[model samples]
Target: MTIAHSLGFPRIGKQRELKKAVEAYWRGKLNQEQLLAEGQKLRQQHWQWQAEAGLDYVPVGDFAWYDQVLNLSCTLGVIPERFLADAKQIPSEVGLELYFKMARGDTNEQGEVAACEMTKWFDTNYHYIVPEFTENQSFAISSSQLLEEIKEAAQQGLKPKPVLLGPLSYLWLGKAKGSDFNKLSLLDELIRVYGELLVKIADLGVEWIQLDEPILTLDLDNEWRQGFETAYNRLQSTPVNILLATYFGALGDNLGTAINLPTEGLHIDLVRAPEQLTSVVDRLPAYKVLSVGVVNGRNVWRTDLQQWLERLQPVKQRIGDRLWVGPSCSLLHSPVDLNQEQQFADDVRQWLAFAVQKNKEIAVLAKALAGDNSTEITAAIEASMAAFKEKNNSGRIHDETIQARVQAIDANMSIRQKPYNQRVVLQRQQLKLPLLPTTTIGSFPQTTAIRAARKAFKAGKLTEAEYRAEMKQQIADAVHRQETLDLDVLVHGEAERNDMVEYFGEQLSGFLFSQHGWVQSYGSRCVKPPIILGDIKREQPMTVEWIRYAQTLTNKPLKGMLTGPVTMLCWSFPREDVSREVSCLQLALALRDEVQDLEKAGIHIIQIDEPAIREGLPLRKAEWQQYLDWAVRCFKIASCGVENTTQIHTHMCYSEFNDIIEAIAALDADVITIETSRSDMELLDAFENFEYPNEIGPGVYDIHSPNIPSQDWIKQLLKKAANKIDLERLWVNPDCGLKTRDWSETEQALANMVAVAKELREEYQAS
Candidate 1:
């Protein structure tokens, strides 16, 4: 029988119980035992769900409390000196916190510790905290989370594929602290660590390991080319069969290198890079098992099984007995299951397939190829065909009117009503701001009461009027607090939004909201991205009521916040039928109308966040411009229609803006805010060197932590930023929004931020 396997499962629970439980543990509300129990429960439930969906090889060790890359760093004992020094007796909980801090800088009572820098994970918005290594990086294989998970799955009579980050991908993704990338000669030692890990798993009686070397999809040099063969050759004697899984893009030049390696099995992503199959089939070694990634992992569209079957035919002809079927990558990018979406209209639902549906597709494909001519499989494929045809014929897509408007948006249309030089004078004059303006990043804490009220309204427990009254009261109080604190700019505090992207997705056409589709963004933080179902169009104004109402209560310049088209399209599970550029353009057109409406409502300043813009760039440098061109064009289309006096701002979080400064500057916002607190204003160097001709707010504080930032800290950051950009054009704010923080921290942090700005202003005047 042809077997089906998964590279990994979504670690986030269906209801996001893992996020809540982890947060509870961090806050001392829940103990370690409780955290562990919750994790185990989630893993068991996930395994059972996949098994029920007919997945033959459910994966273990893919589940992580924080991140899989961080887990591998721990597994290899590559703990950086800083984390090791600060953590005297680090439990896994504290270890996890330190890990996240490395990925996204942290500020607590201990002061600021830079987050481990993050990098793109194969063109996905999902970020892995880059592992920091040193020449002295050692091996410590103490964590048995994988072993325990495998044992648990076996206890339930499920034999599982133990997933691990392959040695080459792990080392390639890491950097050595205070050392140049070229100087780190740790490959030999790193291979030893993996050799040790493989032997240990062999001792645990695991039969197969899904060792992910997704970097095999990228362009590589001789060093990485040499490392692959050297490491696997050393592990050839290990008892476990290593399945080297590569995904996210094509294996152009890397295919020959990969097939030449002495691994037992190879998994190729035919979904994204299907063109490479002609070469992949020709080059595979007779003994090497091939797992064809036929089903799409990153998209939500239902699979066309007939098309998939045709592709699988040639592969089956060559290696029919040895072939297996799987998803292009981990199903983590997709939602957990379509079974939970009870509210979707059947027609819309027919066109959709979540992670669970994708898994079943793989199983059915595997069985059909194995000569099981089940009537259900054929009928399901026919139904998918019918749905595809219906979607094509609906006239919902291909809007000539929208395309004409988009094509009409030329250089003049993209340019704001006023250029920066003029807009600067206009904005400073209109707002009557200081040299360095003080503001928050558009949201205050979303309190339990606010969440409860929103939930009550959604569940029909509270009337719309009651919900609105409470939300208005919350907004009024937030505005009053900012007023008392003497903040120059005001926001509605985003009390009405469950999430930045989801709130807009719920209102916009061509999108579908998931009731239980949740994924962990970071430590204990969850996001449910709206699913793009069809051509996107805005029926009416989405944020007008909230922004207009907030403006009524405040004389200050109220910044209307919207998620940019690129971010909305990037974050959501987009449809496979449409190109991302097309989807973004559709979202851009919808948001353009909203921008016009916000301006009409007399909102002078608007902040459209494109945090995921960098994530959407192509992995290869050569292909980056094409993506960035469309990305910037989409942003311009979304924001350029407003008047010159209307200041447009954009924000990016946890980004290293140096490499892409030119492209970012090309976006041409009047002012931009970015997360700089983590890097201690290291990101500002780009602006300084490039002489970026726009205003900026390098974040003065990190918002991810519970502890407040000191006035001294904010002062230091501002002083650093002032050296980089003109103090006249600089603004002071936190690295990002404060929605995740508690009331005490948010109030204290903002107060300190304002205090720093005031101190800087006094010094400028005195000088």
Candidate 2:
């Protein structure tokens, strides 16, 4: 019989119980024992749910207090030298405290320490802690977290298949610290530790281990490809079966290497690249199990069971009992439960599936493939077919007017009226900004009082007028703080907005909101993304009133903040019925209207953030141009409809822009700000190498960490940035928004930032 299983499940509970519990521990509201209890409860509940959904094996070692990648780092004893002291004390004293320190940084007697750098996980919005490496990196089985979790799962009378991040992929996901060296050189040592780990896991009576190596989807050199063969060959001696899993994209050229590996089984994602099914089935060994991921894991849309059955039946016929069925990737990218969304329209609700629903979809497929076509299984297939049919043919999804507007877009709509050099001169003459102008990336800290007001307003406990007054007061305070610091550019603080994307989606047509749809972005940070159901259109100006009100409170040039078209689309659960280019264009047109309105409202500087643009790039380099072409065009369409005197700015955070520097320049914004402090000004190398035109703000402060930077520290970073880019074109700002930070740290950090700008300005004049 075919096996049914999952790559992973959402660690955040249905109502975000993990987030609350973890945050409470951070704030000293809960002790270590209490926090451990909460994590244990969430794990048991998730395992039980998967078992009830008819999974053949429950996934252990997939649960993490923070992130799975970070957990693996701990297990491998890959702690950076900065956190070595904390690690030494972990065996006897510290428990998961050292783990949280590696993730969130710490301020103690050892002085302030920055956390390991983080970046996007593949193309999804989920963020993972990037593993740090050194030239002489050593590996040892340091933590027993995975071993403990396996025993815990086995105690519950469920078959636990441990999921481990494959050795090659773990090294590939990491960066070489100190100096440049081939990370693959450490592969031999890494495999030794992995071999030791497999033996211990097998000793626990585990039958199968899911080893994920998603890097097979990427273009690899011969050295990296050979390293995979070498590593797996060494690990094949372990007395356990290894199911090599790859997802997020198709394994194109690496298919030969992957199939030849000495693993007992291989998992392929059929949702993203179903075209590879025939090729894989033809080449796969007869003795090896082929896990077919037929259910979509990265999306919310319900799968069409009839269509998938047609696709999977041919593969099942070829492979017979060796076939397995599951989700395309980890359900960690998806929300917890669809049943929690009680506020959604019935039609809209029927058209969606969260993590729990997707698992059931996997089970139903497994039964159908096994020829168990009971009435219940047949009804599930029928319901899935009906939901998809209704979604495709629904009148509410198609708007003739919006479609016509998207069709009518022309080349002229995407080009600026003048070039950057000419526009910069006009912007400078009008605004009269300083040399090293200091500003924020919009959004002051979202204080508890501010959240309370928004919650009260939503609950109808406070009237709209009362809520507006509360927000206006918060905006006023933000403006006063910036003016006192003598920062050159100002933002409205975004006090009235809940989320950058959700705020706009709430006011737009053809969008659906969820009451409990939340997914983790990083540590303890969760975002409830809006679902784009149909053609997008703006009914009225989204940010004009709040921005205009903010401009009235400050003499400085306040930036009109808007989330860019690509980010708005990428961050949300976009429409699957239409092409992404079409949906992005429709969103661009809607934002185009808002951009013009912000200009009319007398807001001179506008910042449209496209942080997710880099995240949205296709995994395959061959397919990048198609995505970049439309992505850049959509951004231009939204931002180009403005005067030369109106300075347009864009901000990107926690992304590697080296490969896409040309595309970044093509956006043609007057100024661009990016996250740099966490990488210690490493991202600036890309802009310098490309001789990127237009002004820039290389963030001098790492806002993600709680540790505050001294004024001197900020000055040194700015000086380092000056060495790469021209001084006149440089601006000063933080790595990203301060919404997640506390007001106390936000104020002190901005003060230090402004002080650095002043010290640098005087030094440049003296020189």
RMSD of 1: 2.5
Per-residue CA lDDT of model 2 for 1-767, tens digit only, reads: 66889999999999899999999998899999999999999999999999999999989988888889999998988888888664443242225888998898887785677888889998989889999998989888888889999999999999999998999999999999999999998999999999999999999999999999999999998999999999999999999999999998899999999999999999999888989999999999979999988788888999888998888888888889899999999999899999988888888888999999999999988989888889999999999888988877789888999989988999999999999989889999999998989999998889999999999999999999999999999999999988998888999899999899999999999898888989999989999998898889999888899889989997889999999999999999987778889999999999999999999999889999999999999899999999999999999999999999999999999998789999999999999999988788999999778889899999888888888988877988899999998999999999899999998999889988888788889989899
Q: Against the hidden reference, what TM-scores do the models get?
A: 0.94, 0.98
Give the top-scoring candidate (TM-score). 2
Clashes of 1: 6
By TM-score, how accurate is candidate 1?
0.94
Per lDDT, the best of the predicted structures is 2
After best superposition, candidate 1 residue 448: deviation in angstroms?
A: 0.9
User: Candidate 2 overall Cα lDDT vs. reference?
Assistant: 0.91
Model 2 residue pairs with clashes: none
Worst 10 residues of 1 by lDDT: 86-95
